[model samples]
Target chain A: MLSEFDLIKQYFARPAAARAQADARIGLGIGDDCALLNPSPGMQMAISSDMLVSGRHFFPDADPTMLGHKCLAVNLSDLAAMGAKPLAFTLALSLPEAKAEWLQPFSAGLLALADQHNCTLIGGDTTKGPLNICITIFGEIPPGQALRRDAAQVGDDIWVSGTLGDARLALAGYWKEHPELLRMDEAQHRQAALRMHRPTPRIELGIALRGIAHAALDISDGLMGDLGHILERSGVGACLDVDALPAGPILGTQIQDIRRRYTLAGGDDYEICFTAPAAKRAEVLAAGAASNTAVTRIGSIEAGSAVRLVDAGGQPVELQLQSFDHFTSA
Target chain B: MLSEFDLIKQYFARPAAARAQADARIGLGIGDDCALLNPSPGMQMAISSDMLVSGRHFFPDADPTMLGHKCLAVNLSDLAAMGAKPLAFTLALSLPEAKAEWLQPFSAGLLALADQHNCTLIGGDTTKGPLNICITIFGEIPPGQALRRDAAQVGDDIWVSGTLGDARLALAGYWKEHPELLRMDEAQHRQAALRMHRPTPRIELGIALRGIAHAALDISDGLMGDLGHILERSGVGACLDVDALPAGPILGTQIQDIRRRYTLAGGDDYEICFTAPAAKRAEVLAAGAASNTAVTRIGSIEAGSAVRLVDAGGQPVELQLQSFDHFTSA
Candidate 1:
């Protein structure tokens, strides 16, 4: 029965873990009309925003803690894509009503991940409405060093961080026609849901790959669609080895074709996909090792305008893998 | 019909006026996953967020153009309250569907205000959901010079920018016993609605008062409620001359007591309230004149713990004015 402001103060106003750093740049945080951040003299602020809505973005009864993690994680993913180091974030949340049970764990999950990345919650707004969470994250990067989609080189090798399709596997309950496979054991269920709900933003790997990767973007709306953005921006295409694409163990039990399509087209992986010189292969692996994230070279950027998949014999695969479009996808 | 991404490209991806400034700091704008801002050295970044839901924050059938203006206006008001110069803003918009008829004018209104303030449209997300608009604005102020709520000192003169009560008076249709006043003529109706809808954030005035005002905040919820925030933060009280409170011409027709109540308790007034030393009264007036915003001295900060209103005869007025609480108010 708390008011909106009261709810914010109780749940969301906890001091950020990053606030204790000696070089912390937060000048003023929550309780003021605006939060103040003091960016270092030579650093550029990287900013991004994401909105998640109930029913559209998640099930109405989805786990509140996981939802909270996903909300901030998606925004942090953008900063990761930019090769920017996390700083602070603001949340503008709208809910049908305020409830203590839902808010306490939600803030816990959110702040826990925020603490992991040293990102601080600076300022935001809370209101009464249909449930929606919008987060804007800020990060810092040196000038001219951010990984950009337009910087992809035609000859660069394309790589993806982490295994793909586990999140979609978790969402099999929604799209899978065979209901029996949808019934997962507790371990598998938790693992798959963790992929979908508590995505790691690859902040460390992004920072490590700063100068090594030529161009980069996070995989949110599937590898195929998101890579298409790099292709269009850099005026190049790519060729992927169908047999070489990495998939989580959960997808191994699925049919080969289904596994291929899901790994390529299913969204919400929150993994970084980048292109780097073939010579930097060792460095890319080193960067992955430093961040403790597995990096797989899946393809190579090419001269044409279409992304094509091929077998080991270089025969073209005729599968049409459609990406998850927010409006057009089921 | 447009997809979410398509809608963003078509409407919200326009370039910013600040991009033309010699000190243009935007490194990457709309098309990127994250926008980059290069903050000048020794400047602190001021950040604030606001969310406006269709029926909760405005009339369901409200003019889309005005709604757009108000959404960004409220956030700008926060930056103004901190005496920060706006740099950029990201709009995380959720709409039931993408309809060009609605988006065209909304973007026009939003961008027009953004252009006037030299604030750039950076990067944000567009999604399908119930209509919600959340904006996070970034502004810059000199380090340690922001107007903070907790900085009010005892015996400082309190001044307000612009007139009050018009916005709440426009809401008379909701609270008034007689409905005839709601049937105002076209010009009158538009004029009154303008006060409620297109509130002018006193950005210039705030910047002008930077060194003069000890503390400042915008009047969003009633004057009594917002002043109470300053008092609570600063550990002081205030004394206001009830007869000296400013009201719009619309409030002139109301009963004296009703006018006093609405001016004191009614919210949505975006005017600023700040405290300054009595010796700086001339400078405060000059700052107001420089910004072309009217200034009125209505009260003074005191050493106690209550905000008391007094009449011309110096007799205290015993009255309780509740501010608009979103959860508790209708």
Candidate 2:
């Protein structure tokens, strides 16, 4: 078992690369009873929380380190939706029991992401349960400048950052407990599984999009499903272009068979999906470039109040929207 | 099972009583998907998170509403310890199954306390897991005004707010699953049961203690145990007046049988254990009185290496230092 001191040092006390991009006034990161960060001037703090349960969010045997990473990633995604710059986070970890070796690697993974994102571990709680991890993240955005799901405007272009479906394909092909194709080199499988375990939250893209994007949300529950949130709240609709979507190579190869199902249904890709006005397209692209972030235009807003799929020829296509719904039939 | 909408509306949407003395930045309370708050000028936000799980923090059959209240209350205690004014909080609730009846009352209880304390609900995650509720709260304090556990000085006067041991007594007498008691109306038993279920956090008093209390922490664990944390971190010991110690009526009744075990081992009862100087006693009392909060002098910080509980005759009592340790066997 890992000692409490060592567990913190290994997992949580570390930093991520983008941390250098964090705003000044962050006094300490991880290893303290609480983390301290000085709020940026003229900014209001935004906070969001998430919980991942073993056997629900992941398989029981998923690596603990990756579990740690994914936990922080989900909360970061929430901050992204608010167009808030990541600052710090607190974790509430409940395990069936404390095991030192498990904690060491888990903390390492969690700290690694925190270091990469420049997010400090501010405070946490530990207890006994069926291995549940809840993370609450803190970020800041200029007041009234926050990107919201209700702000999508008519005549806006819909966009998503990064390729989708890789996580879903990995889950179906690589991480399955019983694989039909005993495939993808074990190391490659580990990497694919790592993606499933630790998704990169688009904090930079989110912050950059604040003044550019009209409405934004992090794509945790597949593009179609999460984008539905914007349409619902904004009282608008979208015409998603199937051909314009940034697809994982695996999805492309399986497109003839899987029919882009994973891209439409897979939920773990922690990317940001947003809408920008036609007039601000250049500014949006410029902000993306300035932040060294990659973003792709995928769709357009519609005056009609229904989401539809458009084929490459701009014809509506029939497709299954198998998005993640906690209450939907399993 | 509780529907998501009703659960949110009934439990989480309620607001606290008007605090004209409180800050005016809580622009919106708990009705919307995300709460909006105005940031106070020159203040930095402090955050903390804690999770309570059934079979870990309480019995599985514990009143779900009280369980919900306790989870949010504890996180509020963290903010109190920092001398921050309550602003907003996010709740991540995981349940094995969805039950609308359970959710409505549970959210009602949470909203009741939130309304009284003026903390808004911004955003949170709700999913399926073994019954656990994780609350992450945010508050703001003036720059460098947040009190912490590590700031105790040797000359400070040790003080505790409210009485203790009622929680221990409630757990022992009211929490036990007695079929005969369950069959009876048992109003007194039920109220006692509430203390064991929902422990109120001291937010108002904590804010008042901002510049007055030198160092402070919420006594979630028993006085001896939590104070030991201050002593260990501050590198000093204490001399507690056993007779002056406030145990309320329950502990007084139980100390005769269990020999003061109730006072020494009770958990929950989110009260503040703090240290100030002799010169500030009247100020501290006035602060509590102004807030309808009670505080008592229980001990004094001393130049010593260990804690010594002195009796009314000024003789040292050889009592074993016992308190709750979550990791250790009960």
Candidate 3:
């Protein structure tokens, strides 16, 4: 029964004491027409936005807390890919109705991740409609130091942080699209579902790899599709080792064909993929270790404009592995 | 049907020449994990976000071009209220489907206004879902010069730019809700609809009033409700002269009671309401004149925490005028 203003004030607006602590770089927080941010003098602001719709992006009855976490986490992943430190974010939410039962856990999940990264929620808008959450995040990075897709070198080694394909494997189980292909125990299913729901933005790994990596991006729409961005932008190609891709524990137990498909073409992985000079392999490993994340070399950049997929024997492995396209895919 | 990436590249992505001209402060734009913004050395970045849903914010079959324009215009109004110069914006759109027919004019309308304000569309996300458009805008202003809502002082004269109530009048006509109280000819109805659909953000007026105005905010919800934000933030009250309000040309011809109701409580008015010292009246008028916007004094900030409404003769008027609340309003 709360009005929009009352709902915003009750749920989203931070108290003065908390606001002051959370808003070191924020000149103004909520309750203003526009929030003001004072970026550090020599730093460039890195910005990205992501929108999640209820039925399209997640189940209509998905856990509100995880939904909130995933929304901000995706945007934070972009900042992580750019090697930018999180600063602040603005959320615009459209909901069918305002209910405390949903909002309380949602905000709690969102703010928890925000607090973990020292990111402030400066301002946002809330309205009544079909449930949609859009977040635009801001981060700071030293000028000329951001990891860019165009900077990939042809001889660089392609690396991925953490594991991939578990989220997609979890999604396969949930949707039952390939029931015969994907089989998982209850414990494995729960673990994979957690990956799909609660993605950790590799902020520390990105920051640590700042000058070590040449180009980087977060993998949301599978490894092949997302790494293609780096290849396309850098005017280069890559020779990916299908057998070398680091798969999640659960996915690693799957058949080789299923494992390759899920790891190479999975969506919602939220893991960073980067290219580093072969000379810096040790440095890259050190950076990953420093950030407490596992890094695996999956491929090597090539000269021609064709992504060549190869198995351990170096024979070309051909497969129709199209990445997830929101409109074209089911 | 275009894939998500192709849709973005075809419609929303700017050509290199256009991008070069638009992105002066942008280091990295579209095709990156995150866009990089190089803020001016001494300026603070002002940020605001707005979301519009299909049925809640507009008619389901509304003109796509105008809808695009209005979506960006509302966010621009926030920058105008803060006396910040527009720099860039990120759009996150959720659409039921990607049709070139809808996207063509929509991007044109959006980019046209952005070009007018020299605001670049640096980065965004597009997905399939119920129609929703969320834009987060960035602007820049010199440190300590932003027009904040909490800066209003007692005895300051409150002034408004442009006119009010035509948008709400158009809504009434379209909805036929109170047909007895509202009447309009075809031309008048078109004019009112234009007011509702194509609001011009007072960016110039706000920039000109940077040092002249004490507190400022754009009137979106209604004068009574939005101005209440300034009063509540500043810990002051106001004495409003209802007769002195500048109603839209069409609303000006309405009955006294109708004009009072609509002018005082109409939503979707993007004009700015600001407070300034009585001694700066000449400077305020010069600022308005320089911006080519009409400015009228409508009230005076008072010491007490109550907003009093009165007529030209200083006789108090009693009216139950509540501002539009999205969740609670019809």
Q: What would the per-residue lDDT of candidate 2 be over residues A228-257, giving only the tens digit for each residue?
A: 878987989888888778766555555433
Residue-level lDDT of model 2, residues B97-204, one tens digit each, is: 777777767777787787777777766777877888888787777877777776788878998888776776666665553433222235544555566677777788
Report the C-alpha displacement of residue B109, candidate 2, in angstroms: 0.5
Per-prediction TM-score to the true structure, in the order listed: 0.96, 0.89, 0.98
Worst 10 residues of 2 chain B by lDDT: B13-22
DockQ computed for model 2 against the true two-chain complex using alpha carbons: 0.45
lDDT of 1 at B40: 73
- Candidate 3 recovers what fraction of true contacts? 0.93
Candidate 2's iRMSD: 2.8
lDDT of each: 0.86, 0.72, 0.92
Candidate 1 error regions (>4 Å):
A17-23, A174-176, A180-187, B17-23, B174-187
Roughly what TM-score does model 1 have, to 2 decimal places?
0.96
Q: Which prediction has more favorable lDDT, 1 or 3?
A: 3
Arranged by TM-score with the best first, the candidates are 3, 1, 2
Please give, for residues A168-204, the per-residue lDDT of candidate 1 as tens digits: 8878845555665444565875687688888988999
Interface RMSD in angstroms for candidate 1: 1.0
- Where model 3 places Cα greater than 4 Å from the true spot, the runs are A15-17, A21-23, B15-17, B21-23
Which one wins on TM-score? 3
